[model samples]
Target: MQMHQTARNDLLLDVRNLETHFFGEDSVTRALGGISFQVKKGETLGVVGESGCGKSVTALSILRLLPKVSARTVGGEVRFHGRDLLDLSDREMRKIRGDQIAMIFQEPMTSLNPVYTVGRQIAEAVQIHTKASRSAAMKKAEEMLRLVRIADPERRVNNYPHEMSGGMRQRAMIAMALACSPELLIADEPTTALDVTIQAQILRLIVDLKERTGTAVMFITHDLGVVAETCQRVIVMYAGRIVEQANVIDLFARPAHPYTQGLMRSVPDRRRGRQRRLPEIPGIVPSLREPIVGCSFAPRCPFAIDICREKRPPFLDVGSSHAAACWRAEEVMGA
Candidate 1:
């Protein structure tokens, strides 16, 4: 198979050959192994993978938040607005963080400071990024709470994170993330801990806010259902590398990569039949203690060939802006 270039479009954030490694006592684990993707202005790039697939690491690398003393970005470049984030000084990176880019973490309980009231937490972000006075910031925090569809914003703002329910805490986190009007928002499983009804509400709130603010979002989740509802484009990661990427509709309609196919097949479809059992991918995800020598998914891939055991496959364009990294690309396409 030959490499094909997809149509070039304006990109808001571009990550190229990103490699984040964590040094342990006996071995160095490669958390992210040369992963690359881009997010366009007013677009949501949904990154989906099983747990421990380097999804969260990619997010932290972009923000330069990984502990540099032990965790190192040994290679690659992360460019935001044409500036290389890896080259930026700590002070410079701090300015970009929360101002140009913001993150809504998975668990609001752990992400939020327990001692601070929700209003004060949001206000701190506002005051740090914008030249808002304490009173003004507090007022804006209340407005932000209202914008996120939280009822009784004035009362909620004064409550600490532990005082609110799970759904309310998630909303407060969203309010705080959007306090500075960031151009890019990285939502790392923001709805994971919420109930079904609240999850849908939060997803809709994110969509509405993005439409209003024109903020580019990197939404990371293990749920394909969430991707279907929230994303425009989807990137499927496996064992630290992107295995498949396509528009949301195309990805669901025709997943070219075997791993992606397995993921789609695994989603429970109760409408199919009462006897339908969810398909599961067998075997465990490979440890990244050492450099991967071959196609990372080869061990679990149903169609893997001999060549797949010895060599890593380059990402090949399947069709219509879709790409997949697999040695048996032709087999996947039935060529």
Candidate 2:
């Protein structure tokens, strides 16, 4: 796939043909199948798809954070600033991981430690990454809390994870992730658990932080609306592969892949009066254990033809920096 064409200097991350799998006793689940994309400096790249589309796996693979017992990165390279992370030793990868490339998970409750105060956790990251004393790191932690727009940052820093509200805890998580001023941040549905108002607040905080720090962001979410508001470019993944990618404006205006089109149609239109049913894509996602022939989404695609069932389509460039992995890309775009 011709996944990226980033200039040498502007690119911060270039993930190429990454494949990750989970090995059980009798079965192997292909979680990521040759997914490729690039994140430029100070850019926000959105990866949108339904559940089980390998969005989380891709993030985990990049950080080499998957459980050693079951998950294994079988093939492909994750290039971060021209260095292949997969080739790095565990000790080397650990140094790069929070200090250079950080991640904010979906649930702050699970990610944060109940035993320690929020400030201590953030300070720990700073101390590990830099040669700062405990007191200095703790002060930096308070600064991080204030940077994220948390109220009473001095007092809030001393509070435990369970003591804060959901929004506060999420903001704390962001502060912890941004403690070291990472070059690239992977936010996996960071606002998924927040209320609409809180979600907007967190989104704004992330955007503002990105602008202030010039850090590239890899935003992984199923919310197209969130993508519209935050991302400059977006890639639509389906069944472990990128089915389409384009600029956010072009993607929303003219989605070239069948899956992308279905996702766009599924969004509710408030202008249309109350409807009996909102549009939905039919059929459940197929299991990854099953051998997939041709296109993985062919069975669920409305535009699937004989060739779609028999042969997998290549990722074809559809113009204007857009690409789609579909046999009927021209027909779908009405070109």
Candidate 3:
């Protein structure tokens, strides 16, 4: 998030005031509420928040992958390469997806076609995007599998989704996403399903692959540990909006938002005795179905003042390139 001598052209993706809602028979659920951020070219940007905080929804919204029947993005612009993605025709959008901006979904089993070999799926993407010959695309697929460090690319490419282990499947997913070498890679909880050891391996693999490919990444996860290991910049979302955005190091060292402080406190502290219960944020997340009168996190924030409960706070500058939507960021950071 550091903007030291940063130019506007350095941005690979620029999202402005994005808002997404899901409509039901009775009421509408506000999934994303005017959240905005940027991803610099070749930098790994992490979006971390608790479940239902619009982390996944942000990714989906950016890709235009949300369910059409229910979810709708009512406002805002998703700009990539100086073009507004929301205004693109479906055909144009299709061409851009997987070629210009690719996404690796959370669950490989659900995403990977059960009927097709892993190789075919990857080759299909290459073929569709690049229009390469079947043989050439298959060759590219094999090369991608090798790139992701999948053992025996020759044999593994022919294996079905079920045939590969969880880690392998996730790797294959990454390979498919990177097959065409997209400029922006959106990985939505890519390591959520894998075991701890496998999770570490996957995280390492993503970092290595991003460096090798020079691809910018939007990594969405609930784990701050993953963010610390992989991201240069971090966006902390709460109640459908970004509460704080800062460099990963600064975010950990001085969390200016009370919600961010609460989240950090919830992380297990090795220095603390085992008998000490993990700290938690005090109140339930505000319901998004109804209108939020003030700061959505004020109900749970320990530093809330009268104005925090009466009127929403604007994003205040905590430092260079660090901002938080909090009335008492100074007190929160010192606390």
Best by TM-score: 3
Model 1, 1-335: lDDT tens digits are: 01211344467788999999999888899889998899998899999999999999999999989986789998999988767899999999999999989999989999999999999999999999889999999999999999998899999999999999999999999999999989899999999888899999999999999999999999999999999999999999988889999999988887889999888877778765567778788898999996777899888888888889899999989897999998786677562
lDDT of each: 0.90, 0.93, 0.93
State the weakest 10-residue window (summed lDDT) of model 1: 1-10
**Model 3 agreement with the true structure over 1-335: per-residue lDDT tens digits:** 33422547687898999999999999999999998899999999999999899999999898899999999999999989878899999899999999999999889999999999999999999999986999999999999999999999999989999999999999999999999999999999999888999999999999998998899999999998999999999999998999999999999999999999999888887876676888888878888999999899988878988999999999989999999999999999999
Give the winner by TM-score: 1 or 3.
Answer: 3
- In terms of lDDT, model 3 sits at 0.93
Q: What's the true lDDT of residue 301 in model 3?
A: 79
lDDT of 2 by residue, 1-335 (tens): 22443336788888899999999899999999888888989999999999999999999999999999999999999988788999999999999999999999999999999999999999999999999999999999999999999999999989999999999999999999999999999999999999999999999999999999999999999999999999999999998999999999999888899889988888887765577487678898989997789998888888899999999899989987899999999888873
Instruction: Report the C-alpha displacement of residue 163, candidate 1, in angstroms.
Output: 2.0
The CA lDDT at 88 in model 1 is: 98
Candidate 1 global lDDT: 0.90
> Order of all candidates by TM-score, from best down to worst?
3, 2, 1
Please give the ranking of all candidate structures by lDDT, highest first, separated by commas: 3, 2, 1
Extract clashing residue pairs from model 1: none
